[model samples]
Every structure is written in structure tokens, then in C-alpha cells.
Target chain A: MDELTRARQKACAGSRLSFDEALLLYRKASLLELGQWARAAKERHSGKNVYYNINRHINLSNTCTALCPLCAFSAKQGDTRGYILSPEKVAEMISRAMQETPGLTEIHIVSSLCPDTNFSYYTDILHTVRKLLPHVHIQAFTPAEIIYFTKISGLSIKEVLQHLKDAGLSSLPGGGAEILDDSVRQIICPDKASSAEWIETMKTAHSMGIPTNSSILYGHIETTEQRLAHLFKLRAIQDETGGFGAFVSFPFYPQNTKLAELYTIKPLTAWENLKFIALSRLVLDNIDHIKAFWIMLSEEIAQLSLAFGADDLDGTVGEEKIIHAAGAKSGSIMTRKKLNDMIVQAGYIPAERDSLYNIIKQAVPS
Target chain B: MDITLDTIEDKIHSGQRLSKEDGLALYSSNDLARIGQLADSVRKKISGDYVYYNVNLHVNLTNICIGQCKFCAFGCKSSSDKAYELTKQSVLSRIAKAAEDPDMKNLHIVSGLHPDWPYEYYLDIIKTIKANFPLLHLKGFTGVEIMHFVKISGKSIETVLRELIAAGLEAMPGGGAEILDDSIRQILCPNKATSTEWLEVARTAHRLGITTNASMLYGHIETKEQRINHLLTLRALQDETGGLQTFICFPFQPKNTALEDSITRTSVWDDLKTMAISRLMLDNIHNIKAYWVMLTLPVAMLALGFGANDIDGTVGGEKIMHAAGVSSQKALSKNILIDAIREAGRIPAECDCNSKIIRTF
Candidate 1:
């Protein structure tokens, strides 16, 4: 009978709505109102509390050939700035993070897609990181990176993942997922992972019991439909894997990169940025955590995002270089105390956690 | 109308509020105009018809910074020949100059966290600007600089902000949020403010009733999930005090920054989609600014329909983001801004930082 009644009916039946119907909520509701509804849905599925883990990201190298236009992290093969962390060096970083933070849980390892490197090189690094810090979980590689690794290792995705898992690869980080729509991918990052490949890799990883994270790189050259398609695709996969732990949304950083030059200086609006995060929370019902990356969205929005739909703020990052190279202005490295204080300020209990979403400590404010 | 409201509530409980599934139906329905109508309707419902804009001018107090962050093209080493920090006199002069402009109602004073400036130096800067342009809305300092100022001034963040607010500081601009993902930050800005510290500053500022604007610098190496994390952080903070005045999303300007050599581009289509999505998503925030300077004029105009209500005013002189190379030079005149709004088929109105309309142009 009424719009609100219809909306409720759709929700009860788990029936989908038309875009026009969706937009009506936008016209008829406030973010607070919508969030309350979403929060209810969330609590029905997931409790109010969200999760984060104590992790370290060890990017193996910055050298790559994809040269995606939106990338501010990848360097040309021969660029003086290009670098490749030797397996020993990678292991050393892992060991240092493990030792530096005795309570460390996950070692998130990833790097630019370098054509010169092979999967054996990746396996060696994984083994090295694992050997040096036997207790730390390792969540490394994207579908693009994994596919590249498989190609280099001459193994199928399953075989490569199995080898890495045995070598201590605990999980997979959802990276290089710009938009699931191929048209946007071609315009922005043609040489990188394709939609099918990216999805397939996640699916395969899930099948292997290697829990993974999925993402959508929005605020780039894609239509509204394209962004939705990306979400639907992730939802589809999560429906299958039940392995995705979190859904992260990255905005296209149009910094001093070629994309800025080509686009003649344009970026997303703040409302758009929040909408992506909120929508991610709304659409990906299967996923548990909605994270707001401070390094990309900045600290203020990240903090505000907690109320919108996000439950988790990522851990104390020791050193972040990839997005910074893309013109991220937020600083790297936060003490445990600082993170706890932030959570408390937001009126939430801070739970120090391990990679698999295990709380190491509760209400830990430094 | 009563039934419509009820149905909307039902949709909310069903988890079919505003997902892609709905967006697809909207797009395929071949009724694109309804997109704007719905977004505008949401705008009216949440914030009313009152669109907001700030009469602010960019006053980058300094270009010197300690951290040689790879993404920055604007910050220079203090010892470098390119480095420059405005003297109080110069800063006063710039404020005076902006104050001279008839339309300049706010003065945005941001800068790199210079190594040499004492914390009092910032307080004094605020004092100087406020003393001269008492009427100007003085929104200044980023969280990074605030962190630096706290260390330099040897005072707590609350103390420094209180002192500054006493000296006429109205608000803080939320900058330096690259991504909430610490992994990305560690590699990019090891020497800058951590995500935790930045949030502390904003949260404290909010607690103090000093409203601020939040931002996100995206289109780089972060994953989609990280972006979500960034928003979640902001949302969480807003849930506390509702202190944020607006959210401004500007893409990273990579021009001559250290990151230039690493990655080379961002996109425009992504920008519009992001604006639209933001309109649909941030149901809490009152206003979203399509920063005309960062997004340029044409797209900014188009964005008004995609869910953006405010086109950031014509900045008289913009540095920092522009030195990193943004579009839209020269201050935007009221006529131009209104014309652009009218061109986009939206009513144009001049408003204060609080989204309260000062005049219907």
C-alpha cells in the first residue's frame, strides 16, 4: 500500500527492489534512518560489535608492468624507485614485526604484480616469513597476484594456493578488485586482473578453506550500475565461499598519477565515498565486517564511518607505502594505545585480535 | 504517503534498501531522471532544501614538512629551496586579502606540519588572523599539523585546540586521511600521523563542539575493503557527537608528488559514481560538497544531479591540493557558481558552513 510497507514486505520476503524503489529510500530517508534499518538487519545477521586483527603488511616489491592508471603504488620495471624485497629481506621484516609486537597475529604480505618475478619467489618468501615467525598468520596475494604466481609456478590456482597454504599462507587479501565490470577495468587497468580471473581466484581460495577478503575499487571510471555489479558479484561469491571475512571499499585516489593527468583533475565527493561504504554494508549480507581504511578515507571519515555501518577499523599500521604513493596524506604507524583510545572515543570497546577474528584482548586501551 | 513510508520501512528491514540490485532495476527501468529525483528527495528529507557551501579561501600556511611522503607533491623539505612557511605577518596579510573579497566568509588555514614552528606559533597565527578578520570563519589545521603542534608546543591536543579555539578557531578540516588501512599508510607516510592519532584529533575536536569536515584521499593502491574501513571510522565518530559539518571527498592529486613515479593515474567516471553512492550512503551527514576545485567545473556541475548538493565555492587562491595540481583556478564568483548550478538544473543558494542558506542566488 505505502512505500514504507512495500519496503518492509521486500525485506521480509528477501525480495529485491527496483533501483527506483531503492532511490526512493534515498529521497525519503536520512542516513541515520537508513543506518538504523541496516543496523537492525546487521544485528539480525551479525552482532553490533565488529572485528579487527593485529597484522603487518609486507609488500614484496613495487615493480610491476600492469601500470594501471589509478595506481600510485606500482613502479615501472626499471624505474629507479622500483624495488624488490628479497625473500630474506621479506622474512626479516616479518620477523621484526613478529618480534617487535610479540602479540602480532597476521602477516599480510602482498606486492605489485611484477612480470620478472615467479611464484617460486613468492613461495620462498612465504616460507621464510612462516619459518621466522611460526605463530603469525599470513594473509597474502590477490587474485591478480595469485594468478600471476600460478602462471609463474606453472600450477593451477588450487595447487599454488595449496603450496602457499602449506608454506603458511593463512588467508587471501582482496586486492586489485577495481570494479567487477570489465569495461571499467579496461579503461583504468587493462593489463591487471580481469573480472573473471579475480572472482575465480577468490572462489578457488574459498574452496580451499583459505578465508579471503573481497573489495571494490569505486569512485573511478565506472557507472552506478558497474559499482552495483561489483557488489553483486562479491555477494555471489560470498554466498558460495562463506569464506569472506570482510568487505572493503577503496575509492580511486586521483593523485599525481597518470589518471589525474588524463582525467584533468577529478575525484569523488565525500557523500559518494560514504555511500559506497554504506552500500557495501547493505549489499554484502554474507560478510561480517565493514571496514573503513583510515589511510585512504582519512581518519575523520574513518571514525565517522563507524556509525554509518562500519564495525572495524584496521589495526595499527606500522608502515604503509602503496596508497601513499598514490597521494594518501594520512601517516603510517599507530601505537596500540592510540587505536584503543580511538575506539573508546567512539564509545566502543576495543578488542585486540588475531587474523582469524579472534580477540586477543578485550577493551584494550593503551 | 503514509503507505509509502510504511513500505520504505519494510524495504529497510528486508535488506533491500539501496543495494546494486535496486540500482540495476532503476537503471534498467529506463527512468534515469528518477535517480536525481530520488536523490534530491533524499536530500530534502535529510537536510531539507537548504544546500550548504562555505565562503572559504585556501591559505596553505606552509609547504615544508618533515615526512617525505611519497604521495605528496606539495610538501617540501624545510631545508629545500622549495620549502616555505608563511610568516604571521604574511599569514595575516593573506587573511586580510581574503577578507577584502566581498564574498569571502571563511578562511581555511591548512599547512604541512612544519618542523620549526612552535605550537604557540599556530595559536599566534590564529590570533593574528582572528584579530584582523573577526567575522571570517577560521577553519584551520589538519590532524597531522595538530599532532605536530602538540609535540612542538609541548601541550596536549585538547589544550592546544582549546587555546586555538579561544583564539577564534572555529573548526578543523579533516585531512591526512589517506586510507584507514594502516598497511597502506605505513608504506606511504611513515613519518606522518597514524590513523589512530588523526581520529583522536577529530574525535576530540568533535567532543569540544568544534565542527570539522572529513575527507578521504582514494584512487590509489588500497583495496575496496579499506575504503569501507575509512568510512566506517568516520561514521563511528559521527555517531558520538555529530560534530562533523560536512564530508569532502577529493581524489589524491599525484602530479609532481613522489608517488608520480610509482603509479600514474585516477579516473573521472569513478568520481561521479562515488558522489552518487555517497549521497545514497552517508544517510547521517547533512551535506556533501562536490569540491569544484578538485573535481573541476564541468563534472562538479554534473555531480549536482548525482547526489552532490554543494559545489565548493570559487577559491580565490588555492594551494596545497592544487600545487599537487588540481583543476579550477581563480576564485569562483557567485554568478558563476549560481550559473553552474542553474546549468545543472538545480536551484543555487549561498549558504554558511552549517548548511544554512544565507541567500538564494
Candidate 2:
């Protein structure tokens, strides 16, 4: 029998695919075959259901100290485009989105590593959203953002997570774990958190009864081995903490970023994007959900990914700025009906989920 | 930048009819994303966010066929292993099972041109189905099947269609129009009705005020120009009659057929581009369906964002595409279909066979 046949057998038998076997499958297996295996794995966890949440995304501010070359959303403190949203403003946006979409269940708050903002700014934003939208789950902060908080506040990551949890932070959004390799990060986001720092921060959050999502920004300066190492690192952490909610694979969109000038880059094809999503499903056995962020991959490719081992298409994200600054063409605001329709059309049940993967409401067919 | 967007984009924005050359230009362009965007703009302007589907069941009466189409695997000779025809009782039983669902609104019936079964045998099946399920919208028979009935019954096209209508055939389905160009048709489906005959039957049905859906079997041996010509021909017919309710584009599935070894299934890229360009070319047709059974649910859902407003319906027991090696489920539940449409971020509106909105979710 061929190596691929052996790998398929191993996968069917529920044995973990080894690193070499997974790399081989990523390199040689047909797209459809890989999709079938990934779909099987996903079905074991999620069944025929794909999950999304009705959430509002609040970017607190664009001002940042670590102006990563891969980022176009961040601005200098005096930059005209940067404005720090006050706690009242964040609360008002959350209340407005809740009024518009009554079923809104989660508030996603992510922002750049701004030096001017103190730890209270982050905590107050969560506290304000929690107070105004009492029923909504507060999913905020990345490990990179946490690490920045640690530096300025002179507190441990665990202490910071505890304070934020007390202030109504529900979970982490897993944004800045972009390709967890220090070598790649040195070129793309040198001033950001190191691989160890991000993982350690997640471990701290998980130990404090806090759940967090994980992500990988690929198709940029990262090597295949580095990509696999990133997945392995995430899997190892999940095996230890068991607190990760979902794993999202973001294709590097380098349209207006400084990274575009340093490296000649091309956006990943639909085939490559689907292949990576399938691979993420096969490799990250401990991670329950694989998310296809419709903002990064156009809605079309993201919808096609439902069959290729993706069980979550994020949410009806309202007012996203990070991806838009990096040149994503799909509009940030997607209606709840539109999100539900995309899931249903892919032959799956669209379940409205919360920050902790709880199904708030199962979709009823018309 | 590979596709110069000056003329066609301007025409689309200005609401002008696209000529055949413009259609060919849209097809040949490599900028699929831009083409999809333009088509999406048109889809939004035409259908808005409403994506239409139906609760329907497809019943193929027989697989025994006289024509020897190279791209078909569903039809068989009388002596072949898969040459069984459904009896009237079996047909009734299928319809009864379909009617058990309260929302089942349409019954779609199409079949091979049986060599031995008389025209009454076909009309009786429709009569029995309609008598049993009175409220079900009976959309039955293709233009080629109509022509075959005309030949066997010794009647004119209009009379044959009228007889079927009297027997409870409410609408016609556009099948067997593989390509409008006779050169390709001569090689692909020679024994089937010619392009002129197919259009003539459709025109007759339209004149009689019988609504019908048109289809094109694309991505085969036909050229880009031939594909455009097929759309233009349908547009011309719709302009004259305005009876075509929707135009469905079926990318040729070449599996387990005579041409399986020589041809392969078209790429998703081509399937999407063709659906978009068809929307751009067929201006008069109100709905463009990306048939989920043929294109798979994922591509079909994506097509909603790319100029396709209808994903057909909750098709039960679909055999034609399954015979051509479709891996998707033959029968999709109503909930699954609705969820698929909603997940694609479009409102899923349940419609009848005539494309009238029954309910929107």
C-alpha cells in the first residue's frame, strides 16, 4: 500500500497522525481526500453543526508602541488616524449593536499594544461592556496585548488575567499568535510577544479558568516546518490546559502593509486556503473548532470551507478595522440572517454559539 | 489587471444589454474576482438579499432511453442492468412519502424517452401524481421529452404539450439543451432534439402561458463563444416570450459515462464564473439557480454571492446527478437547505415552482 493509504488508515483508526505523516498529507494528498479525512475528524466533535455568534467587535484604539510591519491598523500616538475610544463610547457601541441585533451574545474587544493606555483602560472597556450588555459574553484581549499589560503594570500574566476576569473579561480572542515562531516574528512583528510569552500567557489564562481561542497567520514569511511547529505547539498546549476553544487559520493579507515591500507576496489560492484549513483540522486534534474568518478569506471561500474541516465561520462581526486596514475587501458588517444562511447552504446546522462554545440557540429552518 | 474593465463594467453599471462579444469577453477574462463582484452587484440590484429555494421532490419515471448521449450516465438501453421504470403505484407511493412533509410544495418529474412506453403511459403517471397530490405544483417534462412525445403520439408540439398540461403538467424543465451550436450537439447528443426543436417547444409552452425553467449543460466540449451563444439564445427566447422563470447552469459532470475517460469535471472557478457570466448575459431571466445537487452545496451556497439567487430546492431522491458520480446527499432536508442559505449570509426565502415567495426566514 502507498504511504497515503497508510495515513488514511491511521486516521480512520483514530490514531494520531504523526508530524511526518501530516506533512506528507499536506504535501501529497489530494484535496478531496484530505477534506474527507478532516471532515470526519470535525464530525466526531461538531457533527453536522457549524457555530457562529452574534457579536460586536470593538477595537479600543489604533495607537500602538509595537508597530509591527505586518500590521496596517496600528498608528503612532500622534497619528491622525488613531483615537482611543473611551469606556462610554465602547459601552454605547455595544448597547447599539445589542439593540439592533437583540440576540447578540458576545462582545469581541481587541486592539493594538498602545503604550499610552493603562491596564485600567482594558479592564474598564470590559467592565463597561459587561455592565451595559449584561448577558453578552466578554471575549477580549490577546496574549500579546496581555504581555504588553504585564510590562507596563509590573504584574504577572496570571495576576493580570485575574484582574481582567474580575472586571468581566470572559475569554481571549487569539489574534496576535501569528505564526508562533520567533524567527518569523523577528521579521514580521519583532516588538510583539515571543512564542514562549504567548503560549505562557494562554497557559496562565487557562489555569485561571479562562478559555481562549488560538490562531496562525500563514502564507507570509513562515516556512512549512515552522507552520507545522506552530500547530504542534498549539496542540501540545491544548493537551495540557484543555481550555482552547477554537483554532483559526488566517491567510496573510499583505496588500497595504510594510511587509509587502520587504517580501514579494501573493495571496493564497482557494485550494491552498482550504488545504490548510483541512490540515489544521487533522493536526490540531485537541482543538475542538476550526474557524474560517470570513473577513480574511472572502465569504465565498469561507463558505466552501465548511466541507473542508471548518466548523465555525466566526460571527456576525460588526465594525472590524484590523483586517480592513490590511486590505480585506469583504465588508466587516455581516447580518445575522446572512451568517445563518451561509452556514445552512453548506449543508450544516447553524447554531448560535457564545464565547465559551455554548449553543445559545439552534437554528430553526423556515 | 489582466481583464480591462472599461467597457463591460461601464455597460453593467449603465444598465445596458451585453452583446455576444461582451459576453465572450467576460467569459475569457481571468479576473474571476472582479467578474464575481460585478455579477454580485447585479445580483444585489436584481434580487437583493433574498435567496429563493423550494420544498420539492424529483421523480425520474424511467431510466430506459432511446437516445445515446455521450455525457449521460443515467439513461440505459432496455437490456442494460439499470433499465427499470417506475410503475404508477411506485410513483404514487413516492409522491405520498413526499407529501408527508407539510411544506413539500413542488413535484419535479423528468425521465428518459422510453422506447416502448406509449405517450399515455407518461401522461397517466402525471395524472395519477396530480390526482393524489392535488396541491403539489407539478413541474414535469423537458423540451426534448416533449418533442419525443410529439413524435411517438403523432401530434404537433403544441398538442403534445397541451395533452401533458391537461394531464396536470403545469410547467416544463429546460434539459437537453447541452449547447445551442449544432456542431457540438451533433457530436454530444445527436439523437436528442435539435436546438431549434428545443427552443420551439419552449416557445410553444410559453405561448400557452405555461411557465418553464431553462438550463444549459456547460463546461464540456463547447467553446467559450458557444457558451455565450447559448445564453444569448435563451435571452432572446425570454425576450420574445418572457416565460422562462429561471435559468440554471449545470456544469457537465463527466463520471461513469462514455466520456468519463476523456473528460473531467469542471473546476469550481469555472462553475462560479459561468454562473456569474450567465447572470450578466441572461438579462431578462429573473432567477439564476446554482443547482446544489450538481455543484455541491458549498459551491451552490457560494454562488448565491456571485449572481445566483436560487439554489433550486429541498431536492429529494435526485438520481440524474447521482448517476453522474455526485457525492452530495441525494435528499437534503428543508432545514439543511435553509441553514445553508442563511449561513451564506443571504435570506432564505421558500418559493413555489413558479418562483413566488411563500415565506422568508
Candidate 3:
């Protein structure tokens, strides 16, 4: 019997394959076959209805200590380009954006791992933003940044999260979990948190009821095995914590860095990106949401991803800065109407959601 | 059952040299498994299943452009109310801000063909950027900007790119070639870089040992054949120069721009089809990108299965498409980006511009 025939039989029986077997299946299976498997998995998990929400970002600072090579949104201390958002600035940006967007849902907070910043600084910023905007959900901090805060404040990860939680940090945005492989970290971002540290941060956060997201960075120098390893790492952690609410896949945009010279960084093709999403949907059975963050992928592609495996179109973001600095021509700030239009265009229902994937309003198109 | 390595090689060769009829046959065949098998075989053969993306940021030095292309909602007149340009100091500052991110490895610089900026100014800008952040890759200047620089510098495209390369220019962003059809160019960007001009710039860049990317801005008034022609143009250029690295397929965003009055907008079906066809059509190019900023993130994830490999990095700040009124989510953090890719089920490894592995966690 052929290898694919046996694999098909195994897949039909609902028997999970080992990591190596899964890789072989990924490589040998046709796109149609892969899609079929992914679709079946999606149907089994989230079903046909995709999800979207309304959210905004509040970056506390662009100053950093670990200067990773692939970053386009950080600044060194004392650089004229750096601007750490004071509590006032953070509150004002959130307040103005919330006023502009009536259905404003979640306020995502992240910042550089600045050596100068203290835990109180972050807690103060979060508290002030919450004080002014009482209704908005505050999903802030990555594992590494939180770890940095904990180390600075002489608190445990759980204590730091609890403190922030008490101070209006309702959730966490998974930002620092770039390619969970430490070997790759040694080359691209040696100064950043280690792979295990990032996972531990997420695990700790998840245990504390702080639902967060997880992510992967593909198309760089890591081997295919490394890519799978990253997924398995996230999967293992998700299995343990159940704290992860969503999974996002981001490609590297290499336009101006030392790594670009060593290699020519081109964006991944739509098929490869979608295949990954579909595969992620199939593999991350424990996770509830698979978000195709429109900031990283185009809207058209994001819409099509609904069929592939993604179930979430991240909320309407207004005026994003990081990806733009990297060479993104796509602007932030998608209207509810436009998101509805795109959702309908992709043959899905336009369901308005809150930060936690709750259907706040469902618009049935005429 | 008898498919050996030799048979696979033959199949790869056949798929590599596939005709339009072959593509249609594959598209129409009920046996999608077979079609994908063939395509996957081709994919594995050429690039060895290694999809490419980069950690880069885009800095549009100036949105004030001389040519008011019909399709361009981003470019504005220098005297217009929406005109804005980054100064040397500001541009350097933006670069510095971006360089601080450990995951950001490439700097993408594409701008309008400003009428009055001296050639020396462009040269100095590249030199200064390289001098400060010597570690970052400078993928500066689009083809249209390059053409403008050539005209202003009184040098050939080769000499111009060479000088820029010597001054820390690493590669070229394949921009300003709306469509390789002169007729389409006349209608959209009449006074912008000509089809031949864009091709020559890329070809010259490639010949000078600098790999450049090629782009097709579809979903406007261009025909299907025009899309094919655009791909064919890039393919022909690749055939001759071998300088082109990847193909980026951008849909014309008709929002708050001059063209909005004439056209309604591009549908999502057509956009996905274009991205899929790009993967099927461009056999030689190593990568195909579904730029999330223009298309949005959801569609980008969908494109992964259709024929794309990359879903771009976290942009620090973007302006051109915003001026044009193309609303996509901007500033994605590394975590957000990774989560999106992982949600798609593909392994997300942070990479540099040249597809170098950063981290695979």
C-alpha cells in the first residue's frame, strides 16, 4: 500500500499523528487534501461562523533594552526618536480613539523592554488609561515584557500579572513569543527573553485567568523542523494553560536590517501563509480562536482565511505604527461597515464582537 | 505507485514549463489533489518548500508626488493640503526607532517621485541612513523613484543604483510599476515611470548584483490578460536578468482618491484569484507576498493556501495607503503577528529580509 493511503486511513480514523508524521503529511499531501483536512478540523472545532471584534492599541513606549534585529518599533534610551508614553499620553490617546470609535472594545497595551522603565510605570499607565476609559477591555503585555517588569519589581510573574490585573490589565497580548526556538533567538535577538521564559510567562498568565494570544514568525532562516517545533511548543503550553485565547501567524518583513543583507527577505506567498493558518487551526485544537490579524495579512486574504481555518478578524484598529514602519502600505482603522462588507464578501456573516469573541451585534446584510 | 525521484523530476520540469492551458486544466480538474500534487512538486523542486518573509518597516519619505496617478490615492501634490515629507532628521529618527526592535532587520524605503528633490539629496539620504544604522539592510527606492533619480542625476540606471548600493543601499522595493502594459500605465499613472522604464530599472539592479522584487497592482481597470501580461513581463525580465527575487500582488485600493469617483471597488474573490494565479503563474520567483496592510490580515492568511508564503511583519508606521484611504490594521506586534501565523497553522519563524532565520519559536 502507498504511504498516503495509509496516512489517509489514519486521518480518517481520527488518530493523531506524531509531529514527524504530521510534517510528512503536510509535505506530501496536496493543497486540496490539506485544505480538506484543515476544513474538517475547523468544522469540528469552531464551525463555519468566523469571528471579529473592535479593539485599539496603546503602546507605552518605543524605548527598549534588547535590540532584536527584526524589530521596527523600538528605540534606544535617550534617542531623540524614542518617546515613552507617559500616563497622560496613554490615557489621552485611548480617550480620543475611544471617543472617535463608539463601539470601541479592547485596548491592547504593549511596550519596549526599556531598561529605564519600572513596573510602577506600566501599572500607572494601565491604571490611568482604565481610569479615564472605564468600559474598555485592557489586554496588555507579552510574556517577556511581563517577565522584565516582574524582575524589575521584585515580584513573581503571577504577582506582577495580578497587580496589573488589579490595575485594569484584564488580558495579555502575546507579542514576544517570536519563533519559540532559542537557537534562532541567539542569532536574531540574543538579548530578548529565552524560549522557555516566554512560554513560562504565558503559562503563568494563563493560570492566573489572564487569557492571552500566541504567535509564530515564519519564512526566516529557521529549518522546517524548527517551525514545527515552535508550533509544538505553543501546543504543549496551550494544553497546559488553556490561557491562550487565540493564535496569530506573522511573516517577517525584511526591508532594512542586517539580516536582509545576509538573505533577501521576500513576503510569503498567499498559499503558504494560508496553509500555515489552516494547519494551525487543525493542530491547535485546544485553542478557541484562530485570528488572522488584518494588520499583518491583507483583508482579502484574511477574509479567505475563514474557509482555510481562521475564525477571527481582529477588531478594527485605528492608526497602527509598527508594521507601517516596516514597509506596510496597508493603513490601520477599518470601519465596522467595511469589515462587514469584507465579511459578507467572503461569504460569511458580519458579526460584531467584543474583545473576547462575544457577539455583541450580528448584522444580517440586505 | 511507480513515482520515483526521476519521475518526480520530470513532473517538476513539466510543471515548471507549464502553459496557460496547463494552469486552466489544473484549475478545472475535479482532482484538486492531483493539481496540488503537481504544484507542490514544483514548489518543492524550485525553492525547496522554504517560504520567505522579512522583518522590515516601510518609510515613505514623501507622499507629495508630481504624477497624480489615477489609481494612486496615496500620492499628493506638494502644495496640496495632504502633502507630507519626512526630513533627513525625521527619517533617520524613524529608522532609529524601528532599529530598536530586536525582530526588525530590514528597512524598506519607497517614496513618490518628488519633482524637486536633488539627486544629491537622495544619495545623501541613503549614505546617512547607512552610516547611522550600519547593521540594518537598506532596501531603498522603488523603480519609479529610481527612474526619477536617474533623470535628475544625469546617469544611467546602472550607475545610479551602483552609487546607491555603494552608499548602503541593499536592494530595491518593486514599486511604481502599476502594470507592465503601457496602455494601462497611460490611463492610471500617465506621467509616472513607463513600463519599459520600470523593467529596465529592475533589470539593471539585478545585473548590478542587487536583487529586486517585482509587483503587479491589479483590481483596477486592467484586464485579466493585462494581469497575465504583468506576470509575463516579470517572468520575461526574470528570464533575462535573473535579478527579481519575489513577486508582490497588490490590489488597487479605490477609496478616498481621485479614482474613487470612477470605479466602485475590487471584490475579494478576484483578489484571492489573483493571488492564487500569481503563485501558479510566477514559476521562477522564489516568494509571493499577500501584503496584509493592503489586503488586510484575514485575506492574507487565506492567501497562504492559495499561493502565498509570507504575511509581512509588524509595521511601525505607514502613510501612503492611508493617504489613499486603504484601511487595514497597521502596527502588529511580534506576538500578534506570530499568533496570526500560528492560527493559520503554518510554522512562524522570524526571518530577515533575505529569508534569513531569526527565531522559530
| Top DockQ prediction, candidate number | 3
Which segments of model 3 are wrong by more than 4 Å?
A1-3, A8-15, A261-267, B1-259, B271-361
Candidate 3 Cα deviation (angstroms), residue B117: 38
Best by TM-score: 1
Can you write out model 1's per-residue Cα lDDT over B268-345, one digit (the tens) per residue? 544554565555555677777788888776567656766777887767767777777675566677776777676454
Cand. 3 TM to true fold: 0.57
Kindly report which residue stretches of model 1 are placed more than 4 angstroms away from their true locations once superposed.
A2-5, A8-29, A364-366, B1-48, B52-348, B351-361
Whole-model lDDT per candidate: 0.72, 0.85, 0.74
Clashing residue pairs in all predictions, respectively, total 113, 17, 126
lDDT of 3 at A67: 71
Summarize candidate 1's per-residue lDDT along A1-366 as a digit string, tens digits: 998668645543434554544545444544444444454444454454545567787788889878888888888978998999888787677767877876788888778888778777888887788888787788899888888877677898899889989888888988888888788888888887789989888888888889988887877667777777777778778877798988888888888577777775446554456555755666676788878887787655565455456777887777678888888767887667766655554445677777767778886433
**Who is ahead in TM-score, 2 or 3?**
3
Computed on C-alphas against the true complex, the DockQ of each candidate is 0.04, 0.02, 0.15
The CA lDDT at B24 in model 1 is 31
Residues A1-366, model 2: lDDT tens digits = 988788878765556888888888877775556666777788898988889888888898899999998988899889988888998887778778878877888888899888788888888887788788776788888999999999989999999999999998888988899989898999999998999999999998998889999999999888888998899999999999998999999898898888988999766656578779988999999999999999998777887677678999898888899999988878888877777777765557888888788888898754
